[model samples]
Target: MVSSERLADIGYKTFSGTMTLYGGYLCSLRVYRYFHHREQLRIAAENQTEDIIKD
Candidate 1:
């Protein structure tokens, strides 16, 4: 049988691990979004340059 202290320890570790994983997920998403936006801006710039050259 688990003691109260043991249960509290398990709960704390579980919460900490969950938060760590969630933090990593958020960071990964941020990086993906940043690159996606950068790519879109680059494409827009290329299109604009092409239009200017055509004109």
Candidate 2:
């Protein structure tokens, strides 16, 4: 049987670890948004070029 203090300590560690993982997920989401935005811009530019050629 674990003592009360040990259970509290384990809970704290788990909380901190979960927070760290959440931070990393946020960072990756930002990066993904940036790349997604860039790709969209590239596609728009290509479409514009096609329009110009047609005109």
Candidate 3:
């Protein structure tokens, strides 16, 4: 049978590992959103320039 102390230690490690994974997932999502927003801005700027040049 596992000692109470050992059980507590295992629980702590599991919780820490889960949080680490969650943090990484959040960071990846943020990075994806940032790049997506940047690309949209670039496209808009290009379109604006084309409009200005034609006018």
Can you tell me which runs of candidate 3 are displaced by over 4 Å?
Answer: none
Sorted by TM-score, highest first, which candidate order results? 1, 3, 2
- Estimate, for each residue in 1-55, the C-alpha lDDT of model 2 and write its tens digit: 9999999999999999999999999999999999999999999999999999999
Give the per-residue lDDT digits (tens) of candidate 1, residues 1-55: 9999999999999999999999999999999999999999999999999999999
**Candidate 1 clash pair list:** none
The digit string of per-residue lDDT tens for model 3 on 1-55 reads: 9999999999999999999999999999999999999999999999999999999
- Mark the 10 consecutive residues where model 1 has the least summed lDDT: 1-10
Local distance difference test, per candidate? 1.00, 1.00, 1.00
Off by over 4 Å in 1: none
Candidate 1, position 43, lDDT: 100
Per-candidate TM vs. native? 0.96, 0.79, 0.92
